[model samples]
Target: MKITFPHMGNAHIAIKALLAGLKLEVIPPPPITKRTMELGIKHSPEFACLPLKISVGSFIEALEQGADTVLMAGGWGPCRFGYYAQVERDILKDLGYSFRMVVLEAPDFKLSELLNQIKDLSQKVTTLEAVQATRFAWFKLNAVDRLEFCLAKMLPRVINKEEVLAIYRQALQEIDQVTTRPQVNQVTNKSTAEMEQLQQHDQPLLRLGLVGEIYTILEPACNYDIAEQLGRMNVEVYRSVYISDWVNDHLLGGLVKPSNRREILTSSRPYLNYFVGGHGRETVGNAVKLARQHYDGIIQIGPLTCMPEIVAQSVLGEVGEKEGIPVMTMYFDEHAGATGIQTRLEAFVDMLQRRKKSNQVWEQGEQLNAHVPGC
Candidate 1:
């Protein structure tokens, strides 16, 4: 059967490899765009969180392309993500979309169990092959993640920003086409090494804390290239979500449900009972944490109409105020454009630089005045 998967951050390539190993055809949903958001908003529940809406949009787009199966992740948490796949599946089924939605659950205790499901996918699905594929996928993922972390650094400084982006796209293309496990390892190592070597200057990079829905933060398309813009402005971007977070949210959180539940309940004791919504509490927690660290600003991104992120953004203002941090909220709709996002980044970066310079000048002036016996 033809297979598809909804886009998640930068996961398209890794998932494609895993599915390819499983001997499936990959019809990746379109790179997220305005039309993508429109499709999602039109079909998904209006009140659903932003990430879910975008996910629904992605699946609909894939379905429209005649894809018959969707490979997706399952989760467990106060975060609605645990239930997102099931709810979305039923929603699409009700809409009369013909497709199979396969949600991969927490890893089974037995390695044999993991191998069996994996073998069912690969024509040559042996225990060895499964292990190889998983390892390859993991290292490649880490390399990709680190590239993002590094790019998030280079991005804020790139002149003719798109110039460096052109190079990054080329680098990603190089990383994605390797044909073997050894090649995957080599590609990951080489690409990461080169990204590290890219030259940089010493502008005090605006320390921008990234707190958002998991999918959007990880997936470049979902944010419509917001991170690239931030990087071009020489902003040091800090991310709150990671593959590790996904593992914890779904894997460990499942094993320690009561403890996890209690932690959520207690931490959010100030808000309502913990938000079962995606990334809402995480966003707030990340913002508060980053502000405490003295990040220059915080940018919270989520799919449009995402309740968790919206609620998080609602409280982040207070968090920023209490901690003396600047917070900017970026909400994306189908029609979101790079130019508009660029405008905001330019404005935000400019403000941060100006404020920083002003503070420095005031302090210097105070020092000079004291020395001159003036005031």
Candidate 2:
């Protein structure tokens, strides 16, 4: 079977490796572009979230390239994401596309069924081979995440931001091409060293935390590359979502320790005590935690009409007021424009910088007062 899946940032790399390892012909969808966005908007319902539309377009592009199966992840929550796979399947069927829709739902205590489905997908492969493939794919996922973490740290500090991006892109390509863990490690280390070697300004940098819907948080195309944009503006960003962290919570909950979820809940207890579905609680929690840690500001980005993020955005006002941290929420859809988003981001960054300068001046004035004797 020729299997394909929607693009979600670096997820395509590990997913492609996993399917190829399972002895299936993998047909990765083309990189998301304006055409992809147009296709999704044209076919999807008017009210559907941006992710669903983009995913439909991605699947169509892959299917047109001879892929026979579409692999999609399923969710269970009040969030509309849980229904996306079924919705997309219907849309594709109506368009007269012939393909198998494979939905990998959250295990939800039915792990045996999940394994059985995976086994069925690769009947020719043995259990040991599947285990090895899965292990390798996990390593690849972590490797890229490490690279991203490094890139986030270096992007704001490096003198030549474009050079840092080029190194990061090259490193990702090398990681994708390698098959072994050692090779992945070697490339990650080399690229990280190269980034570190680049000349950097010694000025203090603004730290911003990004919290929002998983797809928009992880997919640059959906969020107008907010992380990169902030980085180029000399802001150090701490993102709330990572694919490995999501897998740890949903797919491998039994096997992996849910430390991340526990931390999120603990921090979110004051503002939101329960899951509002999607990453709503996590967004609130991460924002609070980042505020306590003295992050300069926080930005929440998600698709328009996303109920969970909307809930979190409402709560964030109180969080910002109580914690003394500035908060901004950005919602996007098919009609969202890059220029407008960038202008907003630029304004936010400038405000943070001005606030920092004002704070410094106040501190200096306070020090001067301390030196005077009862003026």
**RMSD from true fold, candidate 2:** 1.5
Error of 2 at 300 (Å): 0.5
Candidate 1, 259-313: lDDT as tens digits = 3333433444354345646667767766766776778888888877766777787
The total number of steric clashes, by the backbone 3 Å criterion, in model 1 comes to 13
Write candidate 2's Cα lDDT for 11-105 as tens digits: 89998888888999999999999889999999999998999999999998998999999999888889998899999999999999989998886
TM-score of 1: 0.80
lDDT of candidates 1 onward, in order: 0.71, 0.90
Residue 119 alpha-carbon offset, candidate 2, angstroms: 2.3
The runs of at least 3 residues in candidate 2 whose Cα sits more than 4 Å from the true structure, single-residue gaps closed, are: 110-114, 371-375
Best of the candidates, TM-score: 2
